[model samples]
Target: MTIRMAQESDIPELAQLYQETVLAIAPHYYSDEQTHSWASFAADGVRFREFILSGTTFVATDETGILGFAGIADDGHITSAYVRRDRIHQGIGSTLMQTLLDYAKNHRIERLYAEASEFSLGLFKKYGFHVYDTEIVERQGVEFKRYLVERGVIKKD
Candidate 1:
């Protein structure tokens, strides 16, 4: 698979991937209502497009198409990270995270942070992110828990 900067043309596929991934993974950590509410974010084309363009977004793709994607804003905030449901646990998420981290280091971003869901908590921790806070956030009238995690970008010589 190849990882590259996401193009405007990839939004529709990315949006579908995001929604499918959330719906498929959230059940293990959230209720039906919460999961649907969370997935609803991808339904808003305007917001989704703005999100992809708001920061540096990367997509992983191969013969099968976009397998995963991740994004980090200019201020070092991790906005989105998701792997296709069928492709989870195959290191796609890890690769995407590494890509984001590499980009951060190259851009001199000081720290990286994210509002991570329970499904992604382990991946964040695996990459040295520490939970600084936890919050109950509401999405479309459904509430759920999310972890606020951060990791300093350590430049390696």
Candidate 2:
């Protein structure tokens, strides 16, 4: 698979991937209501498009299609990270994350941070992110726990 900057044309597929991955994976860590509510975030095409454009988004693709996508905002916040449901556990997420981290480092971002769900806590930890805060946040009328994780970037002289 190849990873590259996301183009405007990829928004529809990215939106679908985000919704499907959330719905398919959230259930393992969240209640059904929470899962549905979380998935609803991708239904807003305007917001979703704005989000993709708001950051440096990357997509992993191969002969089949887009397998995963991730993004990092200019402020060092990881805005989105999702792998296609069928493509989970195959290192796609990790690769996408590494790409984002590499971009952060190259761009001289001092720290990277994100709100991670239970399903993604392990992956964040694997990348050396530590949870500095935890909270129960409500989205779409459902409450769920999330971790605020951050990692400082070491710049090479």
Candidate 3:
């Protein structure tokens, strides 16, 4: 797999991956209604392009196209992170996270934060992030619980 910065041209594939991941993974922690409501925006490639262009986005891809992506804003907030359903447990998410972390460090970021879904809590913890809040977030009349996690940047001596 190769990791690189994301460009606007990657939006469509990224959007599709985001949708598939939510649809496939969210059911483990959310109701059908909630999952549908949540994945509703995945088809909006324009918005995805705009959001990714506004931050430092990275993608992990191979011969099969985009496998996963992650993005971080100037404020050190993780805007999005998703790996294709079939690509899970293959280190794609972790690779994307490492890229994002490197970008944050290069920008002198001291901390990072994300509103993480139930499916992502374990991954975040694996990278040393701590959950500071648990809240019920509602979308399109459907409710689901998510965590607010943050991690301080690690400095190498």
Q: How do the predictions measure up, each by TM-score?
A: 0.97, 0.97, 0.94
Q: For model 2, state the Cα shift of residue 98 in Å.
A: 0.9
CA lDDT, every model vs. true structure: 0.94, 0.92, 0.87
Error of 1 at 8 (Å): 0.9
On TM-score, the candidate that comes out on top is 1
**lDDT, model 2:** 0.92
lDDT of 2 by residue, 6-33 (tens): 9999999998999999988989888899
TM-score of 1: 0.97
- For model 1, residues 1-157, the per-residue Cα lDDT tens digits are 9999999999999999999998888998888999899899999999999989889999999999999999999999999999999999999999999999999999999899999999899999999999999999877778888999999998855
- Ten-residue stretch with the least lDDT total in model 1: 137-146
What stretches of model 2 exceed 4 Å from their correct place?
A: none
Question: How does candidate 3 score on lDDT?
Answer: 0.87
Which candidate ranks first by lDDT, i.e. highest? 1
lDDT of 3 by residue, 98-157 (tens): 887888888888899999998998889999999999999787788878899999987643
Q: What is the lDDT of residue 122 in candidate 3?
A: 86
